[model samples]
Target: MGRTSDAGEKILAAGRSLFEARGYSALGVAEICKAAGVPKGSFYYFYASKEALALAVVDEHWADQRREWTRILSGVGKDGGDAGGAQPLDRLRKLFEETEAGQHAVQQGCGTVLGCLFGNLSLEMSNQTEAVRARLQEIFDAQVEMVAAVIGEARERGDVTVNDSREAARSVVAQLEGQVMFAKLYNNTGRLSPLWGNCLALLGARAA
Candidate 1:
């Protein structure tokens, strides 16, 4: 990476943290610039506007999360297959466990950016910034699709008995997102544990 690339990454890193910790609407370009230790002028050199930078931050955050999920999914098997073929439902539960563990490790509730960012921006920019809303929706849709894939795989492997894997996946994703929102709102990270258990039970029953 060149100097320009390095600078861009620094800006993105700062933006990601701020966006995750606060939100897109709460944090300003100047705040991000200051956090990055870069001049305001340099912000425009890398991004057209705050919205543009936000899109980049969202993309970067999504990429990192996808990798994390992939790791957990891949870690469940001796051969390193999707959760090691450990009953797709159980694998999914373990995935949530890992997610919760990550949040606990940071001593922060819900380390994921998607749910919080979307919830915040949807309320603030849905009517104004079509671009931002569209990008957020795209990321969310992809996440739901990934969940659906896992559920579909579980059904195929007889680990789940879903009549509609896609719908089931979407439900799981929705439940997880809602739990995260609730956890953040109340600052009670423990609230997610029961949700996780319930989801696992649903998956198990469906599989049976």
Candidate 2:
């Protein structure tokens, strides 16, 4: 990448890290600029305001998470074949296990829990700005849709006993977000394990 592009990316990376480690309202543009190793003036060149930079970070984070969710739920698209033949429940389990492991890795590397970016941003920005809140809601709605897709598959295949796929999907989202909140609170990835059974039971899915 060119120098200009590199500078923008640096600011974004630093912003994501800092904002994730600290709440959005708790950090400042000068701090982000310092973290990115860019001049404060250069920060303005890339982002018109700190809120703009925060939203950009949100977009980047969502892109990465959306890709992972698609892979986990739908499998990679290739010649009309799934990457794995695991059923919906199995896929859900894989998502849980992988999320735990990924968060653990983040904790080790960054010394922070770095839980759900959407959850973090929503709690901090929900009443702060309609634009950011709406974007966050859009991102979260996509996640709900992805989870709903899995539950729908489970229903069609008779893999689960849930009657309301939408409600069940919301329960799954709430449970996972709560788990992430606790994990972030305690800085322990293992906090996610006990809920594995709770989620499976909530969905009425077969055991892993």
TM-score top scorer: 2
The C-alpha lDDT values of all candidates are 0.72, 0.85
Worst 10 residues of 1 by lDDT: 106-115
Model 1 agreement with the true structure over 1-208: per-residue lDDT tens digits:
4553567888988998788777777888888989988898889999999989888877777787777776655554434555543555666767788766655555543443233556566666767788988987887787777777777787787766657877777778778778877766766667678766667565665533
- Give the C-alpha lDDT of model 2: 0.85
lDDT of 2 by residue, 51-151 (tens): 89989989998999888877877654334467574677777776787789889999999887889888988998999998899999898888888898889
lDDT score of model 1? 0.72
lDDT (C-alpha) at residue 195 in model 1:
68
The superposed Cα distance between candidate 1 and the true structure at residue 132, in angstroms, equals 1.7
Error of 2 at 133 (Å): 0.7
